[model samples]
Target: MRQLLQRLNNNSLYVIISLLIFGKGLGFCLNRKFFFYPPQFAWLMNNVFLDYSMMIAGIGLLVYVCLPSNNNFVLGVLLAIITVLLAIITCIEIEHVIFAGEIEFVQNAISNSAIIGFILWTARHYSKR
Candidate 1:
């Protein structure tokens, strides 16, 4: 049991980061048909730009985690930042869902939860290290 827990802690970062990226891909997959984007975002100005910008930031954090030169401290900080950013985004999306009746908040909340879990897991792992 102890060894299994240790293994899980060591791999937590990779698991959470993969979930984050997978969430993004799932969004695109659900809203796309035959390689074409759904019309859902066509009415919003700069929607694609905003979406891609968020994706870039998420990918950049994943890249940082994957780099060999980083230690647990740096990785933990990055994870915290990503978690906070995702929390804020999740709140914004929640507000939109409440006021504007948008339906995409569920996925955003799931992503945010994963990010928050990652931060918590990182803290525990760092302490154990």
Candidate 2:
């Protein structure tokens, strides 16, 4: 019974992580329209590489999460990659606010930070198992 419960918990965690990755990926794909049209986000408008990289990373992470494995090292590496990407994005948003005097991107930065926190928490949860 304890083993069954543990399996259920792990499965649920995977599902939650998968959902978050999918939502974030979809948001990245859809937000291109908004980023392109907005003058405040002009810096990101021409950066197609960054946009594509984000989508690819999301897909890769989702695939990794779906795989049946108990390897913490691989998970940690993936999380680190994601953290770096998000940090880069957050820094860009902060730069926009500082240079353009726009506070709109601050919300994005906050959201990114929250996601990072959630990822860390998820990693810690898995490490305990």
Number of the predicted model whose lDDT against the real structure is largest: 2
Total clashes in model 1, counting residue pairs 3 or more apart in sequence or in different chains: 0
* Alpha carbon lDDT at 90, candidate 2: 75
Candidate 2, 16-79: lDDT as tens digits? 5545655665666666654433475666544656656666666666566556556777767766
Over 1-129, each residue of candidate 1 has an lDDT whose tens digit, in order, gives 675555446555654564575466446435543211233534442245444544555666555544445476666665665566556556655655676666666676776677677667766665423
Candidate 2 TM-score, true structure as reference: 0.68
Off by over 4 Å in 2: 1-18, 33-45
What CA root-mean-square deviation does each model show from the true structure? Answer: 6.7, 4.4
| Structure candidate 1, residue pairs in collision | none
